[model samples]
Target chain A: MKKYFLPSLKLTLVTIILCSICYPLLIALIAKLAPGRGDGEKVMVNGKVVGYANVGQRFSDDKYFWGRPSAVDYNSAGSGGSNKGPSNADYLKTVADRIDSFLVHNPQVKKEEIPAELVTASGSGLDPHISPKSARVQIKRIAAIRKLNEDQLVTLVQQYTEKPLLGLLGPEKINVLKLNIALDNLK
Target chain B: MNTEMIGIIATFLITLILAFPLGKYIAKVFKGERTVTDFLLPFERLIYRFCGIDPNKEMNWKQHIIALLSINMIWFVYALFVLLFQGNLPLNPDGNPNMTPDLAFNTDISFLVNCNLQHYSGETGATYLSQMIVITFLQFVTAATGIAAVVVLFRAFAGKTTEKLGNFFVYFTQTLTRILIPLAIVIATLLAFNGTPNSFAGKDSLVTVQGDSVQVSRGPAAAMIAIKHLGTNGGGWYGANSCHPLENPNYFTNMLEMFAQVVLPIALVFAMGFFIQRRKLAYVIFGVMTLGMLTFMIPNIISETAGNPAIANMHIADAAAMEGKEVRLGVTASAYWQVVTTIISTGSINSMHDSAMPMSGAMMLLGMMTNCFYGGVGVGILNYFVFLIIAVFISGLMVGRTPEFMGRKIEAREMKIASLIALLHPFIILAGTALSSYILVHFPDAGWAVKPSAWLNNPGSHGFSEMLYEYTSSAANNGSGFEGLSDNNIFWNVSTGFVLILGRYLPIIGPVAIAGLQASKKYIPEAGGTLKTDTATFGIMTYAVIMIVAALAFFPALTLGPLAEFFNLK
Candidate 1:
């Protein structure tokens, strides 16, 4: 044990240098060539940074599209989900409340028409994307408030909606921040 | 098939296809055969000389264990201090404060053991320097430690009564240079390309087009995330783990991370087969493991996809469970990740386990409880080998003959070690739970950092499951959590901290000791009457043994936690 001590210590130090210092530096260097230069990809408008492409931002107004319910209220400083168990009365109540609020906002839509992602707090609590169905469901409220053509808003959503890889994986979804940004661009 | 299922199938199939060649490469690496990675030899030699370790110097099993544990001890202490003083340290991009002593203890031990059970959110809990040095650094070494230790087990099978189980430093260094580092570069590059942050920049403040300002936390996350999965060390750069968009990015990277975490564990099984010159036996073991994974995995997929019954009863349109799940991942991928991460003990999650349906939670618990179905890196095979030993002994008893594994007699000493190691897992988990339960019920207001009454995230049976999940995860050295549990309090931090150490080191010691003992015994020649341990029959026997052992130890606790919730929901 005594014999191994010096070697083990020396080896651990070298390993830390290699793994933590050298390796991360190398990856960070290579990341320089990547999109956003390894800093988060920012969605820019009029040369002004408007949230990260990946990190979700909360939008509570009726004039714009909103993302999924946020457990952390879309606080990007830290992230998390509601972590509510399916059988927990409190969590179910939270869901019920989300449903009630969604109904009040989009009274033209039936309660059953509410997409689950719209009401459920996403795992990251900062889910940037909502299913295309979720985006469409909000057309009536946004159109009524912004006085925009409903069809025009619908096409704008389709434009921002990201298709699944090869249309064979994942769900078709729109980044709420991007969609809302584009909505602001409409005359 | 639906596109969601397509994603799941592609991810898994790609992993299986890739595991074959990777396994062969790993086998060659440890066996000292010439390979593509031989270019790394000169660099490895430099490390050995600098560390004053003779790469050719072979150590007995006892020395190997000592060397492994000693370094791990150094790392544990070093990391604890770093976390406690991270606020004063450089790389304070976000200017994160120091961790409480108890939380530091839990975090250090958790990462040191490859458990990575984070009590604090990564964004605020650790500075960038600590993230790289402690979390990312420990992630690599701890995984390499497991791979290094299991190489001794390989020699035990292939050797003819020898104590030269190869040099621990050589295997350890070689694993990093040849496998983990190389793969990390590729994976990290791809992740960076797909929107994971890579800059040293601190949190970037952005004004949403809608006039709301937000702090977008950024750091050197791509590299940490790569090895975090590759090492099966699932500590997250963000509080939300892989569920964080920057951590996972998209479906492609999600599949990439999932595939990355399982690859080595699967490869090592084949490496063992290649090392021991028994491909058929490896298949038998692989078969039982896959069967076990699918058993729990399918139920989780069904439950998660069927959605929460409680939510369905709310008359909502969707029946699929999406709470604490991302829309991009949908249900199938999230469900697959829930089972795969726990079963492999990688513990990376794309969704929250806390919000899973009662049945899904039970299955996740079962995955960790049976922790050997394609477990963590090299540790998985080591664990499966212990079950193999038990199966061999039981069958030998049934046949009224002396038991033998790889022509080595299974004596009382070896059996004692194996049985105790097997028992230790459940012992620590159950004992820890009982203690926590006692504290919560008897001393709700114990003068701890956080009172026991407030420890749990949910009420009633679900809360009980939270306590049970923490212990089970610690006992299995699985770091994934029911994150809803407001842990980081002294009670949880201290209790689970102890469980993490005992759970990790004891299991490694047990397997290495058993392998060493088995190697030293005389190699008896094969005979007509010797039990054919590599056949399908033995696989069934081993499967039965695993089921009985896991069910017997954990069923009542499951009943009290997930099962009660399950039936009540019905």
Candidate 2:
């Protein structure tokens, strides 16, 4: 024990310092080398800026698409989740309310067809993307309101689908605002 | 009762078999007793040649200390830079931008002190290029350091007036080369096999069930997931924790992760005992620790399986309220993981603990409070040894005999130091909880101003239980959270961060100093009546000491939280 005192203390202290300092610096350098846009480009139609596809916006109309549940009132400056767990009575009540609200707006839609994301908020309230299936499920109502054929809208949805990067990155998804703008331009 | 528990129990049994062989191999290598690990002899010679490190040359204690300190300081500075600039980093598929000044500072201290408390989510706020590099590197180094520390301490326990404290560089390299890296690869491979996502792309597109095109957020999730569990560092790549499905897809992966997180720390105890030639004592410590963890977990799992009666009363019968949990994980896995993670000081979670049944939540909190008993990696074993010494002494005094642990006389100073180390977290937790609650209720514009008496979400005895759980989590260096509390806010972020650092370091420094102090003293041979620590009698005393100390310190706060919540629920 007498022989090991200095070395153990010295070794333990040194190890903590190495971890706390050297590692983070190396990661920072690697991150600087990684590529991507700092912020996404704004979506616009007819010279009027609509919204950024990187952040979610409210879709109150019955004929439009829906996104995940949010804690923030769709305020990007204050994006958040309710942080409510599945067992919270409030969480259950809120989801039930959303079910009722969705039923009122899209009476043609069946109860089971309402996607889970529509009733539950994403971890981050700022999610700007929805499932392609979520969009397709609302296709009939959206196409009817915009006076567009179901097949044309399906084509439009395909146009909005962003595939996995290089064909093998992540699950494919569609940008919500872009799809909404395309709906506005439907003949 | 859940299949997930069955799967986890199986994984532990399998990993235990694997760990013994591996631990034996490691023990042999470190003991300087010749073994197959020396097969990497040529690589060692090559590394020594490449790095200009000479193994044949014996260095004094000071020289070894300098080398260790220099490498650590480098990591510290690296972590600081990353914390200051996490934005503009690559592979941030969600394009999370940057942490605020307060949050960045808080996170910096949190990791630097080894607190493992995460106040900010990685998915939303941008973590800069520098921050990612610094943070992950810090994680890798800290883990290596922990294993390295254990290696050095093991040599200390075995040495008889020997000047050698073991090779720092060799220990560090071996920790990374042999332990962490290989474990990570195997676990990562297993996770990938189980369908956990592993990718570098920023985004992907998927067709929804409803037929709309949607963009999915993507990044290097698999890499982070492996380390987060392996290191017992619970910081998540996605904010939803293991619930992100991609990070913890199914029960098989969840089981593997639980094993990966827990097995190392437990194995290290055996490794410690083996190195010191006190394998019997190690088994006793392991037995006591396992009993403590299981006591909390079995009941918590059963309560959760019972489902929420209130929901049943409403005729909702929501099927076990596996809301914050993965459907594949179900109640059993979530309950077991919650307990395992808390026991091991790994904060990673597959379910939102804040949403668990009150009794289950209380169990999770209790696990953290006992974290000082057997924490992460080296720290846990070190903590247990401290209590071992104290318990030996106390029982020795009761029997009117000398306390000798592993043939060394336990003296007054050693016992004092050990007691101080073991008691540090309990003090910090109780005080921190009271202080925070006071500030929340009394401070101007404090978040708790509108404290809803009845609608307080967690209600009755549980309200204070949430507070107690948070305090326990932070103070014990177990970062799993009670979801009912608003912890992401500034008050908690700041206060919890403060408590977390003290909670982690005080206990660490206390035991470390004791070990160092013990090392400098001459060993006294055991007499005929030495109070043996390996006996079952000693094991019960050690368990009682740990549990009683924790209960006494936390009883009032527990009353406020779980106790109150329980009464109200009734």
| Top-scoring candidate (lDDT) | 1
What residue runs in model 2 are displaced by over 4 Å at the alpha carbon?
A1-187, B32-73, B89-94, B126-132, B161-164, B205-207, B211-214, B444-463
Per-model B-chain TM-score? 0.99, 0.90
| Per-residue error (Å), model 2, residue A112 | 18
DockQ of each: 0.85, 0.07
Instruction: Report chain A TM-scores, every model.
Output: 0.96, 0.74
**Residue-wise lDDT of candidate 2 within B1-570, one digit each (tens)?**
323445556766876776666666667766667775566778656655555555665433444445555555555555556665556555455556567666776676666554456666654654434334555445565666667666666765675644567676777666765666556656655555554444444544433323334454444445556667777776666565675545665456766787778777877877777788878877888789887887888888787777655444333213354445443455666787888888778887777776677778777877888774457877777677677677887898899987766555668887877878777778878887777666645663534423323223454455556667777877766677765575655566677777876776556555655555555457766666767677888899998887887788777777776655545442
Model 2: lDDT of residue B312: 44
Model 1 agreement with the true structure over A62-88: per-residue lDDT tens digits? 888888989998879989998888877
Predicted complex 1: DockQ: 0.85
Task: Give one digit per residue, the lDDT tens place, for model 1 in B250-286.
Answer: 9999999999999999999988899999999999998
Candidate 1: C-alpha lDDT: 0.91
